[model samples]
Target: MGCMQKCEMSLGFESGSVTSDQISCSNQEQYTGWYSSWMPTKARLNNQGFGCAWLSKFNDQYQWIQIDLREVGVVSGILTQGRCDADEWITKYSVQYRTMETLNWIYYKDQTGNNRVFYGNSDRSSTVQNLLRPPIVARYIRLLPLGWHTRIAMRMDLLMCMNKCT
Candidate 1:
């Protein structure tokens, strides 16, 4: 039987340890409008009307953003923030990881089965945190947005355990 992995509430986010600087998205706005291509950065959290990655209004059709950690590290937690301008945030999302550059992606699922969706956040200003107990080692982390309130927009950061990273 698969062991259920509950979200550990006591584990807090570790700041100033993330090593991901490369970011990529599935859909991005490229018109001469407000949406700029250089909006998405490796920043910890971006506020609305600021430096947030904006995905095309595709309505959660295979939309995602990936972070390259450069090296394998023990990921203890994740922090996600919505556009700070309005009350829009990712409602349901899933996480995937791969240790090597040529390996297949693995879903970070729970014990019962594949945790299809993770309830991210409700408020824009509030940052949603997911703590991993018995942290997993990964070199690449991808944030897949399955559902959102209005449009898909986000800023992500990983709470990396540098000492345990291998």
Candidate 2:
């Protein structure tokens, strides 16, 4: 990844629908009130009060949060922040995406099977980012946390460039 120069245009969460694998609070039968924190706004990290989605109880399996852009767009970069209330953060992660109406996911990787490992935030308050070279044109993006110390948690934002400037 190289330095991300600001483009004249940038697309964000406001441009799409976001969802996650975290259990919601709607189904009372399986819902615990504590896990009711999957709202898209929780990823903004503006304040410290439950500012991130606590996916599940430290399950060793991979957990993910995804965004549907509703249409195809070129994703230029990703910004991530850790859970503000806890020291836990995703130390290693990989990204995969799919284009419009496609069920197949394309892993962001090099010629080698190894995918790019994003070094996540070291502290809860700070932010980390990974800028994609030759931006990926896709409508669906998924963040898979591959490494975790305690549990999987993250606040993410996508940067997309839709138009070119002189």
Clash number by candidate, in order: 2, 0
Q: What would the per-residue lDDT of candidate 1 be over residues 1-166, giving only the tens digit for each residue? A: 3444333322221233433246666654442355553344523465335544444445555877777777786777878877666566788788889999899988888877765467787877677878776576888878788878787766667676643222
lDDT of each: 0.64, 0.63
Q: Which pairs of residues collide in model 1? A: 3-111, 48-84
- Model 2, 56-162: lDDT tens digits are 44445455666777778788888877777887677777888888544787789855767877777777667777888767788777777778656666666777775
Give the TM-score comparing model 2 with the true structure, all chains together: 0.75
TM, every model: 0.75, 0.75
Deviating ranges (above 4 Å) for candidate 2:
1-10, 13-31, 38-41, 45-47, 111-113, 164-166
